[model samples]
Target: MATISEATSAPASEAEALAFARRVLRDEARALAAVRDRLDGSIVRASRLVHDCRGGVIVTGMGKAGLVGQKTAATLASTGTRAYPLHPAEAVHGDLGRVRDGDVVLAFSQSGETEEVLRLLPTVRRIGASLVAITERAASSLGRAADVCIAMGNVPEACPLGLAPSASTTAMMAVGDALALLVARMREFTPEDFALYHPAGNLGRRLTRVEDVMRTGRDVRLAAPEESVRQVFIRLAGPRRRSGAVLIRDDRGMLLGIFTDSDLVRLFEKRREDELDRPIGEVMTANPLRATAGAMLGEAVELMKARKISELPVVDAEGRLLGLIDVTDLIGASPEDFEE
Candidate 1:
């Protein structure tokens, strides 16, 4: 066999290389469109089977199709369905035990005759799992064995050699996404549900509830509206995490205003130490910007950026203070959160 550097020739020119790349992309795009046009009731039936599955979905395929299957399984799992990718070869080698009765097996085979994929169908059926096939022809053995077949019609590979899996795998992924998203819609999967599944990424952090990230209990310094500023500071002082502001609330627990360290500093900047003995509400920013407990942390960040405030108090429907979202609390917040 010739080494890669020995067998391959350099590109004639950048322009020619660019043109070839465009041709490949156009070919794949056209093939994908053809697959889209060929979609039929089979996809709907497959979606219904996946949506109604009592057990998890088990996606299986071989080679390139197996790679597509892994992505498809992840999409399904993230969008509210329980899904796992099982290698066809591994399925026969003890992984078949993962399949249960009432489970749906989604198998991908561009040629509809992948030996390993075909081998798993009998045991899957024996386990009482329904099979859904994605292939080039509905008449193929995998399709014939499936409860419903989503035919990819005829997708030509974009490779010049016409052997590599390109457009076919793309078509498989597109169809898999359609099936997964359709079922997610059927289940009415909400953003909150998605957030629960994705709890560590930027998306998860943005969708986090204000109450979940806010400083509650003693971490939040709540001062009564009637308290004097001098007394408020002395009482709120502790070794706990210091918040920049003191939330002023009425006797009934209704938030009234906010008095920040900035406010105190300004008071002492001039000869106004005597005013510290006055009621804190008289000097506080009354009816300050606030967020509700149910609001997302992203919305609170936007509010903070717009208002140029660092501390935002969270309240309930009746305006009782629940917690505070200080700038310190948003330590790992995205740069966009701090942008004006």
Candidate 2:
């Protein structure tokens, strides 16, 4: 039972400090595992309530619980469920109007007796909105008033003083996440649906389709396989920025091969300039790696990395070139960039 000053004043080795930190994390992890094991019918009931809700899900709490509720609401909203955070204190000041009939209100309070949270219950019920409570005690006032009560069983604080909320808030947040994700799964949420919510950041860049960023139409340099390399280069040379490769196609527009600036350099270095006047197909790389228009940019990047190529032709089901994906376009991308 050391005071804050006493704890700070005591000299502890790095090992001691690391051990203490590990203990705190272990305690919280154990508490979460306990909550997971003890989950009962209440979770099912809560999920059903949210899934059947025709209107948005309204989440509210006070203090740390409120912060967790806000994050939970955001998770739900981004995963296809309509949800928003309503501050309990603000609810009394007319913000309660944000709640409507058919909305499912989720209230988070470790104690289940938070005054501000309890004060808003009656109004939430009167609005014809169903109430769900996440608390440590299902028998507490907030639980009793709720249509469904999700109990966080006997979570002890990781704080040595047992006064500050620690393990309890962690368990509450975990439960909130579980509910949100379960509801998302019940609604059969897809990655496309997730992308719609997150259209910025690295996530957006990873989810972007090849067609979205690829060079198409006049921007693509296409040449017949029988065309001379010199003729192809002359046609491709212009003031506009260009891709490093030329797509070789047949009269039916089917992709046959690809000729790149690198190939031209190799030809000159090997003194094979005479071959350039022959059919470009004779020197071009045949059956090059390609992607589809609907494929993710990340996928095209992986293919390019594995094959050690800079350009990937985007084709349709019939192998007709739709566009080209350049490695420079995805220069900064990584495997982790595509993870949800």
Candidate 3:
């Protein structure tokens, strides 16, 4: 056994440490590239088995592979496939009841011989569930037992001692992701479908539609192009939160221009309080940037940022005003958060 100091001893130099880190990354990347090249009929078969299953996918593994299995299951579930992770150790201890007929079991074991995972194979078959094994060696027990075996192609471990699971686990994760994403593409999974599963993070905010976040109905500050600025301000003032800009529309309900509180301040500063009594169209911004109600909230945010504007109007095909999206609503949002 090694002491903490011995275990964490410094390398010859910082450069050597960085070189070692880079080598580890390069080794793992090479493993993934090899796995990618090795992908063949087995992957397609595994994907089809899971996709056609009447029951949800059950992902099972032991140790580090178990952690990777959980992530794989989560990715599948989020991408429109029903999936859940199962611990092989727990499955033998009565949790095997989770398996059911017509279900697909994805077992992860780099060497294809993890005892816990292998032990569950017979029970999985007994339950009438199909098994898909992901491993480096197709000749191993688990691989032979599986209905389909996805070979990871033997690769050198990133660990110097070749004891820790590094390159193999990375390849397994990459393969799992490939299968899930391919299935998603085959099912024509849409962003809306993804949003349904991820509704509580930056992803949710990005996927949110303009209609879901915009101020609509009476909450929208509306003004006729010909209405006096004074009249528009009086009508817009109230206990309810008011948008910074008032949407100016024509009698036919088509958007004409936008008048903001900033315009009012400018009027006062210019000693043109008399303009407050003038038609609001005289001081309003005409042909402002706008979004459709069905447009993504992130798209609206991007438009606002690019145009250096604080408010965006939601309109219909005929330019009818539907609602308003305020910059304050997007205060905490970041551009990177919206990238797919």
Question: Which 10 residues in a row give candidate 2 its minimum summed lDDT?
Answer: 2-11
lDDT by residue (125-240, candidate 3, tens digit) is 88999999998888999889999999887877877767789998888899999999989988899988887788878999999888888888887788888889988888777777
**lDDT values, one for every candidate:** 0.90, 0.87, 0.88
Model 2 residue 178 lDDT?
92
- Residue 278 of model 3 has an lDDT of 89
Give the Å error, residue 18, model 3: 1.4
Error at 5, model 2, angstroms: 9.4
Better of 1 and 3 by TM-score: 1
List clashing residue pairs in candidate 3.
none
lDDT per residue, candidate 1, 1-340, as tens digits?
3355533556689997887789889989999999999999999999999999999999999999999999999999999899999998888999999999999999999989999999888888899999999999999999899999999888888877677899889889999999999999999999788878877767777888888889989898988878899999899776988789999998888999999999999998987999899999899999999999888788899888878889999999999989899988777785384343
TM match of model 2 to true structure: 0.93
Best by TM-score: 1
Error of 3 at 116 (Å): 1.0
